[model samples]
Target: MMVFTKYLEDFLMKCSTIGRNSATGRLAIGVGHESYESSHLQPSQWYGEVRELCGLANRPCTFPCTNNLSPSEAAEALNDHIASICQQLPPLDTTRLPAYLPARLIAPTVSQFQVLQKLEKTRVKRGTIPLDLPMHLIKEFAMELATPLTSIINASLQQSKCPSQWKTVFVTAIGKTQSPSSFGELRPIAITPLPSLLCESFATDWAYQDLAPSVDRRHFGNMRSSSTTHCLVSFLDFVLTHLDKRKSSVTSIFIDFKKAFDLVDHITVISKAAASMGIRECLFP
Candidate 1:
């Protein structure tokens, strides 16, 4: 599943279009489901597809809670806070940094990635908020710095025409293993033309919007059809909406019922839902 997710991410980064296709009236496909573990059966379903689901909400939240720390634990808590914030900062490495700053100044300042060069001559210790700094004040500073740093760094490296810049950004932004040659063609999630225009429309009924949930059994035949795009996007949007929400939380539980499909015990789920809707069916052959 990890391999599949990685491959899918790579594929999305490439061949997919980001703008409206006047030729086909379709834009791009939405992909859900991160590859967490491999399974013998496919993960898609009719009412809800499991494969495209994000694992965040079900996983455990690890962020250190303020309620559990002591006076001396403050530093450790601060480190946790810094680590969480650092994970979101733009990539940093020798090739991507300003030509002037020393390598020693990189990591610490990378938490403040946009302004590392600005403070190379000054000493801002890592994990140590200044004495006079209030907690909110430091957070505000980090947020303020994060905006321009991200904008400047992204603007500088996002050009597909420049191989050198793309290579560096590719290695830094996505990961070293990802190929820069194909990186330029990569697309960010849901930023495409069709999806962008219909963002609101799709948000309401993501799964039912375009393709039938059953289409996963085969490749899209009329791949260029507008209906295909809408359906696929809706299916994907459903997954992304859930995943996005999950990503913001900090805990998740991944359970694989020994025979998930065969032993699902769907009778309970079906009966309850159907009963409320005044419908009844065995729904099984």
Candidate 2:
């Protein structure tokens, strides 16, 4: 089971139409079956069928909330459940600065060239934002838009606050298995605004240089060239070394945390990360 916001359909439609024949009228059957001509029917008429062929919306979920609840009720229930688990941070402390950090820890100013540089690598984008401005359009106007974007980013950094619009996000709930009976079985993936994501990239780079030395070698999740496969390989090598080469018994235990990411203390993380870079003032508002 999978749950997606309405924005996903729009995003998929846009993605599908790019460099491909998404016209539902072209939908056809292989052998000993009926076929349809492009001129015969409207694409929207076969929207679901066309999407199926494209491997989109394969897990069409009518949330169990559909059983005995209205849309508003389901939304409220999901929101409440998410809020209960996701530990949102307290308001920003703007009045004072930590003694060890610099008095002002504003984000760095970005140049138009810097913006263009990042935009030019658009082809290498690893993530996309849902419900925000279209990334395709943003890439199309990258050059002409860089200067103003740089200005906006610089102003945002100087003021130490981001636009409220960036706060809006769509959370897609994906189930771990074919049938998910409860919210606990679903993983919430938050899709953010493009600008907010871009800003995060820049800010993360600010701390990257200072944060490298402090990172533990065993940490395999977010570091460069580290992935689940790499971790697995390392674990296997460790077991082999201990059991075969070093003549020791191998023992291990795996612990699973329910909705681990939802309980993150993000404010403390940001504070520590910023402080590591000699940045004292709060940037989030």
Candidate 3:
């Protein structure tokens, strides 16, 4: 797995170098948004395996391997990835603009109406009783429904007075997706938060607190040893501030890089890791 992660790390260094330069070339230019639906397989397990082999815990990403690559190689790889991103969109000039994130948020909302519907059903079920219902039981149901609604409403009201500063961006440089069909889809586009503001939750929030105790001791030890939350939050804030400045719409692509970890080209990743470490790419390749 470690070997595989090395390969993937190299690939990302190459890609990031490719992409970053492309972004710089047209900085003053505007952007636009596009809406489309695509399907793919989820490749997170593969990514995870490779990451484990590489002795990585938590979400595996490219930043760790950056230091290992030469400045020139890193720049080149970033250029490639940037070029890839540019290839997907309409041409941009000083006038045209794109807002990519909003469209991305909407697409998932459209795709998951069914899940939301299930939640509604759950809400209904929670309200119902066997007709031999106890009054106290009915009261409890009412209390249950009230809690989430109250929480949401209160949070909103509290936030109302605050500046609408939800501009955080979480970039998933590579990711995987699962389709209802037999196979999955994969892509190598950077995925920011739909609103860009909810990135805080992605990076900082604990989705479920109760499960922590049950997790393996090895995993816990790993978590303690390998943590980057503080640094990530600082970077997230920086990107959000930078991205939020666009006056025009930006093209945000919320893509699922299916089996991103597994599908990573091992040789490419290894090369990147080796380069980062001041080892010659030729030797590793």
Tens-place lDDT per residue, model 2, 206-242, is 6565666788788798777789998999999999888
Candidate 2, residue 123: Cα displacement in angstroms equals 5.2
Q: Return the TM-score for each candidate structure.
A: 0.16, 0.69, 0.18
lDDT of 3 by residue, 1-285 (tens): 456556766764554455543422211111135222212312333333434444465654334334566977755655565456435544424122222222322111111233233233332233222322343543355435444433442343334222243332222234343221111222434433222222222222231232345555434223544455654665577667777887733454456764445445554544444334333221221
lDDT of 3 at 80: 63
| CA RMSD of each candidate after superposition | 28.3, 8.7, 28.3
For all candidates in order, the CA lDDT equals 0.35, 0.66, 0.38
Q: Per-residue alpha-carbon lDDT of model 1 for 1-285, expressed as tens digits? A: 577656655543342343223232222234454233332322222102222442212332232333365855744544444344435534334343223322232211122442433333223332221222343443446556445554443333232122232222111122123332322222212121211122222222332232344345434544435466676777676567777884453343546543233333344534443344322121111
Compare candidates 2 and 3 on lDDT and give the better one: 2
Error of 3 at 68 (Å): 50
TM-score, cand. 3: 0.18
Indicate whether candidate 1 or candidate 2 has the larger TM-score: 2
Report how far residue 219 has shifted in candidate 1, in Å. Answer: 49
How well does model 2 score by local distance difference test? 0.66
Error in Å for residue 213 of model 1: 63
